[model samples]
Target: MLTFSIFAVLIGLLAINVPVVAAIGLTSVIFFALLGQGSFLAMLPHRMYFGTTGFTLLAIPFFILAGNLMNTGGITRRIFRFAGAMVGHIPGGLGQVNIVASVIFSGMSGSAVADAAGLGQIEHKAMVDDGYDPVVSASLVAASSVIGPVIPPSIPFVLYGAITGVSVARLFMAGFLPGIIMSLGMMAALAVLAKRRNYPCSACRTPAREAWASFRGAFWALMAPVIIIGGIMTGFFTPTEASVAVCIYAAILGFAYRDLKLRDLPGILFASLHQSVSLLFIIAAANFFGWLIIHQKIPDKIIAGLVALGASQAHVLLIMMAVVLLLGCFIEGNAIFLITLPIFMPVAKIFGIDLINFGVVMTLLIMIGNLTPPVGMCLFAVDSYAKVGILPLSREVLPYLAVIFAVTLLIAFVPGIALFLPRLVMGGM
Candidate 1:
C-alpha cells in the first residue's frame, strides 16, 4: 500500500508537470510521513550532500567546461575538416560528414547535447546549401549526437559507476566496441538512405595528403580521449584527475590556436556550473526516493514477484528495456537514469547479470531516449539550432532509429560486444 501510494503520488506530480527533482522529493517526504518515520527527514540533507559531493562526479563539470572551451577554441571545425576529408566523397556528402564528426567528437566530449549544439550549425547549413532536406539534416545530426555518451570518458558511465559501485575504468573500456558499433550502424543506415535519394557527393575527393594534413591539425584534439582512457586504464589517474587533464589539454589547444579567449572562460564556467547543479539536484532527490524504496523493501518485493512469475534473466531485461523506451518518450534522459538505475540495479543483480554489461545497455537505452520525442535533449538542441519541428524530425529519424534499435538488441543479447574490450584491456572484468 505504501509503495503504491508513493508511485501514485509520483505519477500524479509528473502528470501535472512538476519538475522531476521536486516530484521525487515531495513523494519521498510523503512516504516517510505516512510511515510515521519522522527521523527519515533528517536523512534528506545527508543524502543530498553525498549525492553531489563525490570526487568522480567532479569530472562532469570539468568535462563540460573543457567541451565548451574546445568549442570556443575551434576544435569542432578541425574535427569537421578531418571528417570531411575522410567521408565527404560518399553519397550525401555533408550528411556522412555529420556522422563521422559525431564519431570523432564523441571521443572528445561525451555529451550528446553538447555535440548537437556545437556541431549542428555547420553540418545543418552545409547540408541545406548542398540540396539536402533541412529536416533530414537536423534529424541525422540529432541521431548521430547520441554517440557522445556511448564513447569513452562517458558521463553516463561515470554516473553508473557512482550509483552501482562498478569500476569506472572497466565501464569506459566496455563502451568502446558498442560505441563503434553504433557509429557503424548509423553510417550504414545513412548510406542506404543516401543511395535511395541519390544525394550529391563531394566535388573534390580529398587526396590522402589533404586527409593527413587535416588529421595533423586535429591531432591534439584526437589525443584527448587516448590520454583520458589510457590514463584511467594505466592507473595513472582517477576519472577526476583525467577531467583535469582534459581541461589542461583544452586550454593549451585553445590558447595556442588563439581560438578560446580569456573572456570566454566566465561564460564556460557558468554553463558548466548550471548543468552540474541541475544534474546533482535531480540525483540527490532520486537518492532520497531510493532510500524510501529501501526502507519499504520495494525492490525485494518486486524481485520476489518476478521470481514467482518464473521470469528468466533475458525476460527481465526485455521488460526493463521496454519500460526504458516508453519512459524515454516522456521524461528527460538524466531524470530517467537517476530514477530507474536504483530500481533496476537491485533486480538485475538478483539474476546474476554482470553490472558492466548492464551499464552498457542502460547507456544505450538512455541515448536512444535522447532521440525520442517531448524531452529528447539532443532533439531539442538540434531543432532549436536548425529551426526544425519535432514531428518532422521524428519522422525523418525513424529509419535511423530502427537501425539503432537493432544494434541495441544485439548488444543486449551478446554481452561480449559490450564487455570484451573492457575485459581484454583491463585484464578481465
Candidate 2:
C-alpha cells in the first residue's frame, strides 16, 4: 500500500509538471513525513552521494565531455562525410547517411542527447538541404540517436553494471551485435520509406576514390570506437579509462583537423559540465527514491505477488517490459533504470534469470524510452537542434520505433542475440 501510494504521489507530481529530480526527491520526503519517519530525511544526502560515487559512474561525465568535444571539434562532420560517401546512394540518400553516422557516433558518445544534439544537427541540415522533408529528416535523426546507448560505452549500461555487479565489459560486448542489427533494421525501414516517398538517392554509390578520400579524412575519428573497445577487449583499460583515453583522442583529432581552438575549450567544458551535472543530479535523486522503494520491501512484495499469481519467468519479464515501455513514454530513461532496477533485479534473480541478458534488454528498453513521446529525450533534442516541431517529429518517428521495439523483443526472447559475444569471449553466461 505504501509503495502504491508513493508511486501515486510521484505520478501526480509529474502530471502537474514537477521536475523529475524534484518529484523523486520530494516524494521520498513527503512519504517519510506522512509515515512519521521524518528523521530518516537526514540520510538522504548520504544515499544520494553513495549512489553517484561508484567508480563506473566516473565514466558518465567523461563520455558526455568526449561527445561535446567531438561535436565542437568537428568530428561529427567528418563522420557524416564518411558515412555519406559510403551509403548516400542507397534509396534513402542522406537518410541512410543519418543512420550510418549515428551508428558510428554511438561508439564515441554513449549518449542519445549527444548524438541528437551534435551529429543530428549536421545530419538534419544536410538532409534538408538535399531536399529530404524536414519532418522525416528530423524523425530519422531522432530515432537513430537511440542507438548510441544500445551500443558499447553506454551510460545506462554503466549504471546497470554498477547496480547489478555485472561486468561492464561483457555488457559492452553483448551490445555489439544487437547494435548492428538496429542499424540494419533502421536502414531497411528507411529504404522502404525513401523509395515510397520518392526521397532523393544518388545515381550510384560513391566512387572508390572519393570513398577512400572521405575515409582518410575520417580515419582518426573512426578510431575512437576501435581504441575504446580494443582496450576493453585486451584488458588494457577499464571502461572508465577507456572514456578518458577517448576524450584525449577526440581532442587530438580536433587539433589535427585544425577545427578546434584553445578558445573553444572553456565553452565546451562548461557545456559538458552543465550536462554532466543535470544527469548526475537525476541519478542522485533517483537513488534516494530507489532507496525508499527498497526500504519499503517493494521488491519482496513484487516477487511474492508474482509467485502468488503463478507467473512464469516469461510472464514476469513481459510484465516488467510492458511497465518500462509505458512509463518510458513519460519518464526519462536513466531515472526509469534506477527506479526499476531495484524492483526488477530482485524479481529477475528470484526467477533464475541472467543479469547480463536482463541488463542488455533493460538498456535497450531505456533506449526506446528515449525515442518515445511526452518525455522522449532524443525527440526533443532533435527537434530543438533541427527546429522540427514535436507533433510531426512524433508522428514520423512511429515506424522506426516499431523497428527498434521489434528488435528489443527479439533480444528479450532470444537471449543469445545479446549474450553471444559475451559468452563467446568471456566464456560465461
Candidate 3:
C-alpha cells in the first residue's frame, strides 16, 4: 500500500509539471515518513553523493564536454556535409542525410538531445530549405536523434554499467549492430516515404572530389569514435580515460578547425557544467528513490507476481518493453533508467535474460520515448529548435516510431542482433 501511494504521488507530481528530481526526492521522503523511518532522511545526502561518485560517472561530464566541443568546433557540419555527399542523391535526399549524419554524430555526442538540438538545426534547415515541410523536417530530426544513445560511447550505457556492474565495453560493443540496423531501418523507411511523397533527391551525385574533400574536412570528427572505442577495447584506457582523451582531442580539433576559440571555452565549459549537474542530480534523487524500492523488496514482489502469473521470458520482456515505452512518454529517458532499472534487473536475471541484450533493447526503447509526445526530450528539443509544433510533429514521427519498434522487437526476439558483436569482440556474452 505504501509503495502504491508513493507511486501515486510520483505520477501526480509529474502530471503537475514538477521537476523530476524534486518529485522523486519528495516521493521518497514522504514514503519514508509514512513508514515511520523518518531517520532515513538523515542519510539522503550520503545516498545522493554515493550515487554520483562512481568513477564511471566521471565519464559523463567528459563525454558531455567532448560532445559540446565537437558541436561548437564545426564537427557536426563537416559530418553533415560528408553524409550529404555520400547519400544526398538517395530517395529521401536531405532526410537520408539526417539519419546518416545522426549516426555519425552519435559517435561524438552519445546524446539524442545533442544530436537533435545540435545536428538537428543543420539538418532541419537543409530539409526545409529544400522544400520539405517544417514538421516533417523536425520529425525526422527527432526520430534520427534516437540513434545517438544506441551507438558507442552512450551515456545511458555508461549509467547502466555503473548501476549494474555490467561491463561498459561489452555494452558498447552490443550497441554496434543494433545501432546500424536502426540507422538502416530509418533510411529504408525514409526511402519508401520519399518515393510515395515525391520528395526531391539531390540535384546531382556528389562528385568524387567533393565527397573526398568533405570526408577530409571531417577526418578528425570522424575518428573520435574509432579512437575512443579502440582505446577502451585495447586496454589503453578505461572509459573514463577515453572520455578525457576525447575531450582533449575535441579541444585540439576545435582550435585547429578555428571554430572554437579561447573566448568560447568559458561558454562551452559552463554549458557542459550545467548539463552535467542536471544529470547528476537526477541520478542522485533517483538513487534515493531506488534505495527505498529495494529496501521495500519491490523487485522481489514484482518477480514473484510475474512468476505467479506464469509469465515466460518472452512475455516478461514484451511486457517490460511496453511498460518502459509508456513510461518514456511521461518521463525523461535517464530518469526512467535510474528509477526502473533496479526494479527490473533482478526479474530479468530470474528469466535468464542477457543483460547486454537487455541493455541495448532497454536503451533503444527509452530513446524512442524521447521521440514520443508530451514530455519527450528529443521531441521537445527538436520542436524548440525547429519551431515544429507538437501535434504535427508527433503525427509525422509515427512511421519512424513504427520502424524503431519493429527493429526493437527484432532485437528482442533475436538476441544475437545485439549480442553478436559483443560476443565476438569480448569472446563471451
Candidate 4:
C-alpha cells in the first residue's frame, strides 16, 4: 500500500505540473509522513548530501563548464564550418551539416539541451536561411540533439555510472556505435525529406582546400573529445580528473583563439552553476525517493509480479523498456533515471543481461523522450531557433523519431552495438 501510495502521489504531482525535483522530494516526504516516521525526516538531508557526494559526480559540473567555455570560445562556429564543409554538398545540404555537426559536438557538450541551445541555434538558423522550413529546421535540430547524450562524455552515462557502480570509462566507449547508428539513421531520414521537399543544396561540393581550412580551424575543438576519452581509457586520469583536464584544455584553447576573454570566465562559471544546481537538486530528491522505494522492497514486488506473468527474460526486458519509454513521455530524462534505475537495475541482473548494455539502451530510449510531444525539452529548447509552436515542432519530428526508435531497438537486441568497444578496451563485460 505504501509503495502504491508513493507512486500515486508522484504521478499526481507530475500530472498537475509540479517541477520534477519537487514532485520527487514531495513523494519521499509524503511517504514518511504517512508512515508516521517522524524520525526518518531528519535523515533526509543526509541522504541528499550523500547522493551528491560521489567523486565521480564532480565530472558533471566540470563537463558543463567545459561545454560552456567551448561555446563561448567560438568552438561551435568552427565545428559547424567544418561540418558544413564536409557534408553541405550532400543531397540534404546544410541539413546534413546540422546532423554531422551534432555528431561532432556530441563529443563535447554531452547534454542534449546544451547542444540544442548552443550549437543548435547556429544549425537552425543556417538551415532556415538555406531555404529550409522553420518548423522542419527546428525539428531537425531537436531530433539530432538527441545524439548529444548518445555519444561519449554523456551526462546521462555519468549519472548512470555514479548510480550503478558501472565504469564511466566503459560507458563512454560503449556509446560510440549507438551514436553513429543514430547519426546515420537521422541522416537517412533527412535525405528522404530533402528529396521529397526539394530543399536547396548549400553547395555543390566544398573545395578540397576549403575543407582542409575548416578542419584546421576546428582542430582543437575536435581534439577535445580525443583528449578526454583518451585520458580516461589510458588510465592517465579518472573520469573526474578527465573532466577537470578537459576544462583546462578548453580554457587554453579559448584564450588561444581569442574567443573567450577573461571576463567571460565568471559568466561561464555561473551558467554552469545554474545548470549544475538544477540537476543536483533532482539528484538529491531522487536519492531520497530511491531510498523510500528500496525500503518498501518495491523492486522485489515488481520482480515478483513480472515473474508471475511467466515471461522469458527477453520478454521481461522488452516490457520494462516499454514502461520506461512511456514514463519518459512525461518525466524528464534525469528524473526518469533516478526513479526507475533503482527498480530496474536489479531486474537486469535477475535476467542475466549486461548492465552496461542495458544502460546504453535505456539512455537511448530515454533520450527519445526528449524529442516527443508536450514535455520534450529539446523541442522547447530549439523552438527559439524556428519561431514555431511546440505542437508543430513535435509533429515535424515524427520521421526522425522513427529513425531514433529503430536504432534504439537495434541496440536493444544486439548488445554488441553498445558493448563491443567496452569489451575490447576493458577486456570483458
lDDT of 2 by residue, 106-158 (tens): 99999988999999999999988999889999999999999999899898888
lDDT of 4 by residue, 100-152 (tens): 99999888778999889889998888888888889988988999899998898
Model 1: number of backbone collisions: 0
Lowest-sum lDDT 10-residue window in model 4: 1-10
Order the candidate numbers by lDDT, best to worst. Answer: 3, 2, 4, 1
TM-score of each: 0.97, 0.98, 0.98, 0.98
Q: Candidate 3 regions off by >4 Å?
A: none
Per-residue C-alpha lDDT of model 3 across residues 244-269, encoded as one tens digit per residue: 99999999998999988999999999
Runs of candidate 1 exceeding 4 Å displacement = 1-4
Off by over 4 Å in 2: none
Which scores higher on TM-score, 1 or 3? 3
Candidate 2 local distance difference test against the native: 0.90
Clash counts per candidate, in order, are 0, 0, 0, 0
Model 1, TM vs. native: 0.97
Q: For residue 339, what is the lDDT in candidate 3?
A: 84
- The worst-scoring run of ten residues by lDDT in candidate 3 lies at 1-10
